[model samples]
Target: MSDPSTASIVSTPRAEQPTETVSPVGAPQGDRKEKPRGLLGDAWLDLRRKPLFWISALFILLFLLMAAFPQLFTSGDAVNGSLDRSLGKPSGDAWFGYDFQGRDVYARVIYGARASIVVSVLSVLGTLLVGGAMGVIAGYRGGWVDAVLSRVADVFFGLPFVLGAIVILTTFNGSGTSNSQWKIMGLVTVSLIVLSWPVVMRLMRSSVLSTKEADYIVAARALGAGTGRIVLKHLLPNCLAPLLVYGTIMVGSFIGAEATLSFLGVGLKSPVVSWGIMISESQSFIRVSPSLLFFPSLFLVLAVLSFVMLGEAVREALDPKLR
Candidate 1:
């Protein structure tokens, strides 16, 4: 009915309206887009999805709870022992059985968690604080300071861990007063800190050196940020991820080191329940009551493995190269 030109114009399809793709829920696709998460956030998201992370985290939490309040785990006395109950099998009250000294092996094992966990945790913290600070300083301000710190680290690194711990602990042992539980723990912690910090220092130093040259750092410098501000605000944050990963793995290593020192008779003394000391005492009874050795060893292995697994999982999550 319309004119030919008018009809042609009407018949021509209008340019397709640029319709936004809608999601199943009828929201625009752009609105459904995910926001970006930074490094730590991304790592956390990844960590949450990993079964290994959850398992390790759960085990570590349980150990921490046990260490902090051992009473929750057991009420039996770890030190008090009855000669009559010596080498007894697992019974009604005693889940792991009596040890060579007739102490409730379960109680001793539970209580022992305190010393080992405390020592490893404290030593690692000390290492991180002292080593991390020194490393940051040296890495940020290279040249003579770095040289001196590097040399000092090398000197400490050259000293064998076990041998150094033995010598240091022997000196403390000679002091006689070091026989106390806290004193023994202190000596062991100090010895470990002295030996262990170099590795953390080197790691942190390397991380810092690499990070200080990043575009953000240069931008901060261009913006007239002071050295202290740049290091504290920017560089340190970047350095922490790798350092934390190392610290986690080192926690397990430190635990093993403490056990080794205790086994060598220079770690925790009598009256201070520890897995290593338990292992040392139970070695002779292995032929008679293998449970004594088996139970504590099992716990130690579990603790170490948990931390190691956690470290590995975190490393995988944080490292883009791994992804």
Candidate 2:
């Protein structure tokens, strides 16, 4: 038997309710507060958790390296193939072998990087500038501006994009004399942009239309944020993810189109070293020295495939629907 007071005290929820204890060794009250996660933190965590992102990043890095350092990897002179060593297969001296003209397959492939990068980068930039602006304007403005721009885009879209590029390059009169390498490249780039803008513009316009109606945009509006501020600061940033994804994909397409044009003799002519030009030059000797076509075509395929993979990876990373 226990004393009543003692019994009452012991039974009074002492065992049922655990006592809260403070330990100096435990996390401090101030230190225990949750820190807000940042965009970088989220992205980093996502990347670590996802395998596709890493694979995509790796390929993108590889292509960037190839594009940046052509001289380091390639052997022999890109332009001057030795006639004496013509039609040689892959040897220690020339890894990719010599072309029909005795040019190092390695050198031409490396130098071809310049043309691939040039056409893709410039064409994508032109697309972004022209299309992105139009999209923002149309999406934000709506009404007459959207109608007119949309109609114009449709008109351009009706034309065959590659054919249009060919026609323009043929007539545009480029920078280089006779061959017109620079001018033809510029012309083709511009023509592609003209046709390409509609796709980007439509994408951007759709993105903006959805983003502009979000709570943040509405809140900004209520807070007296100017149209310019809302657009540039709020809407534009949100639109970038999709645009970047598309832009990456577009690089491959643009490069392929440029190569096709060059192969057809409507693109960069002689004196300019383009993979497409190399392929075109080797068509006759394709049977005699397939190395001429194989190496350049190989590089082209790699470049295009790398970009495509990169774009898909980025899309998976950024798109909530995909995730």
Question: What TM-score would every model get versus the actual structure?
Answer: 0.91, 0.86
* Tens-digit lDDT string for candidate 2 (1-323): 88999988878976578877665766567646577765445555665776666676676676566678876676468887668988888989888888777888788877887876788899999999999999999999999999999999999889897778767776775433665567667777788898889999999999999999999999999999999999999999889888888999999888888788889887777677778888898899888878788888988887788788777867776765665
**Model 1 clashing residue pairs (backbone):** none
- Which TM-score value belongs to model 2? 0.86
Candidate 1, residues 25-67, lDDT tens digits: the string is: 7556754668788999999999999999999999999999989
**TM-score, structure 1 vs. true:** 0.91
lDDT of every model, 2 decimals: 0.91, 0.82
Instruction: Give candidate 2 misplaced runs (Cα > 4 Å).
Output: 4-44, 48-52, 174-180
Instruction: Tell me the lDDT of candidate 2.
Output: 0.82
Error of 1 at 223 (Å): 1.9
